[model samples]
Target: MLEVKDLHAFYGKSHVLQGVSLSVGRGEIVALLGRNGAGRSTTVKAIMGLVSAQGSVRFKNEEILGLKAHEVARKGIGYVPEDRAIFPDLTVRQNLVLGIKDPRKRGRWSVEEVFSLFPLLAERAETAGGVLSGGEQQMLTLCRTMMGDPDLVLIDEPTEGLAPKAVEQVGEFLTAVKKRGISALLVEQKLSISLQISERLYLMGHGKIVFQGTPGDLRANEGVRKEWLEV
Candidate 1:
């Protein structure tokens, strides 16, 4: 469903993503794994048009490299950044309402349905988003993105600082997304979760994809893991 070829991105002459290439099939979850500076997040930002990029980014066979971020989003892609960007003063429900692409048309997900996925959101529906716990904020961001009815989502560090239980909840969220036939490009640090949930994984090093294979293949290749993944 998504393909990136020779993608390059920069931050004021510091090239962060250099010739990165990968693909995500329909209804498939692909994990991008690497150390802190391996350029995983830059890859997604380039695809989303949040950064200036040069190369080919195609979703469903159409080039989307130069489109603006909002334009790319209208093309059925959602992004959940690592920072958990949510409106601090808005009520949880109100924040969710803002994610609706069109109020007149019903999409694949609803506020009530997302509330079902994370009951705490329903309980805190009227609470200010700034006051929620870190985990709750993360959940709210994920559900709010889903509220747009995206065909694919680019999630960056969904489990970064959460407790174990919250991490498990993230796993559940990914499973739910997969069950609904949504594609995901997951940038994650937890190797265990990535190996458990991803059908395929790509290991990045020095701003390029160094390995691409199944979980089993990654498991069997100790040298690749030690070089590109293990700390």
Candidate 2:
């Protein structure tokens, strides 16, 4: 559903992405795996037009590069940042309401649907976002993105900073989200978690994709893992 071809991005004079290219088929979960400073997040930023970039970014056969962030979001793309940017003062429901756009749908997202997916969030519907735990905040962020009814969601490190049990819950949540036929480009440090959920994997290093294969192929290829991902 999305294709990034020979993408190049820069922050000031420091070049980041160097001829980076990858693709995410419709209804598929693709992992963008790489160590820190490998330009994984920058690629997502460039695709969303959050940063200036040179090259082509096509989503659902339409060019996305050079469009504003909101414009990209309007074209059926949603982003859940690594930092989980929740509004500190807004109630859990209110924060979700802000992220729930795409008025073409029936009610965007019914409160029942959200609560069903995240029972914890349901119980804290009126609580301020600042008071929620990290795991709760993560669930809220993902639920808010889902409320937008996006075809593709770029998720950056959804399980980071969570306890083991919470991490397992996150993995389950992603699986459920994917079952809804939403394509996802997951940028994560935990290869095991990503492998459990993604159909394909793209191993990146030094701002370029060094390996692209199925999850099983990636798991068996210890040489590539050692050279790029092992730290």
Candidate 3:
């Protein structure tokens, strides 16, 4: 559903993504794994047109390399940034309402469906987003993105600072996403979750994809893991 080829992105004079290439098939969950400075987040940002990027970014065979962030989002791609970007003052329900691209048309996701998936969100429906816990904020961001009815989502560090229980919740969220036939490009640091949920995984090093294979393949390749993934 999504393909990136020879993608290079820069931050001022520093080149962060160097010829990075990867693909996500329809309804598949692909994980991108690496150390802190391996440029994994930059890859997703470039794809979302949030940075200065060059090369080819195609969704369903159409090039979207130069499109603006909002334009790219309108093309059925949603992004959940590493920093949970929720409106602090808005109520949970109000924040979700903003994610609706069109109120007149019903999309694949509904507020009720999101509430069903995460009951904690339902309990906090009328509460201000800023007062929620970190885990709750994360869940809210994910649900808000789903409200846009995206065909694919680029999620960066969904489990970065959460507790084990919250991490499990994120795993459940990903499973729900796949069950609904939504594609995901997950940038995650937790190898256990990535290996458990992702059909395929890509290991990045020095701003490039050094290994791309199935979870089993990654498990069997100790050398690759030690070099590119293990800290």
Candidate 4:
């Protein structure tokens, strides 16, 4: 459903993505793994047009490179950044309401449904987002994006710094997304969770994809893991 070819992105003179290429099929979870400075995050940002990029990005057979970020989102792509960007001043419910692309048409997910999925969020539906705990904020960010009913979600570092329980909840959330037939390109540092959930994986190093294979294939090739993934 999503294809990126020869994608290049930059921060002024410093190039961050150097011809990165990858694809995510419908209903498939493809994990993008790498260490810091490997350009994993830049790859997604480029696809979303958050940064200036020169390359071919096709979603559902349509070219999307250089489109505005909101245009990309309207084309059925959702993004959840590593920072868990949420409106601190808004109530949890209000934050969720903002994610709906069109309230007139029902989407695959609803606030009530997601709140039921994560009762922690349901309990704090009226609470201000700034007052929520870190894990709670993460959940709110993810659920808010889900409220958009995207065909695919670009999630960066969902499990980073979360407690084990929160990490596990993130995994469950991915499973729920898959059950709803949503594909994702997950940029993550947590190999265990990625290996457990992803059908295929790509490892990036220096703005290039160094490895592309199944989870078992990734495990079999210890050299790639050692050189590109391990700390």
Candidate number with the higher TM-score (1 or 4): 4
Summarize candidate 2's per-residue lDDT along 1-231 as a digit string, tens digits. 999999998888788899999999999999999999999999998888798899999999998899999999989999999999999999999888887685556644566788887889989999999999999999889888888888999999899899988898889889887888899999998898989999998988988999999999988999999999999
Per residue, candidate 1 scores C-alpha lDDT tens digits across 1-231 of 999999988889788888999999999999999999999998999999998889899999999999999999999999999899999999999989988888998999999988887899999999999999999999999999999999999999999999999899999999999999999999987898999989999989888899999999999999998998778
Using TM-score as the measure, name the better of candidate 1 and candidate 2: 1
Clash count list over all predictions: 0, 0, 0, 0
lDDT of 4 by residue, 1-231 (tens): 999999988888888888999999999999999999999999998888898899899999999998999999999999999999999999999999999999998999899998889999999999999999888999999999999999999999999999999998999999999888999999999899999999999999998999999999999998888888888
Off by over 4 Å in 4: none
Looking at candidate 3, what is the lDDT of residue 109?
91
**For candidate 3, which ten residues in a row score worst on lDDT?**
9-18
Over 4 Å off, model 2: none
- Model 4 weakest lDDT span, ten residues long: 8-17
lDDT of each candidate versus the true structure: 0.93, 0.90, 0.94, 0.94
Best by TM-score: 4
Model 3 clash pairs? none
> How well does each candidate superpose onto the true structure, as a TM-score?
0.98, 0.97, 0.98, 0.99
Cα lDDT of candidate 4 equals: 0.94
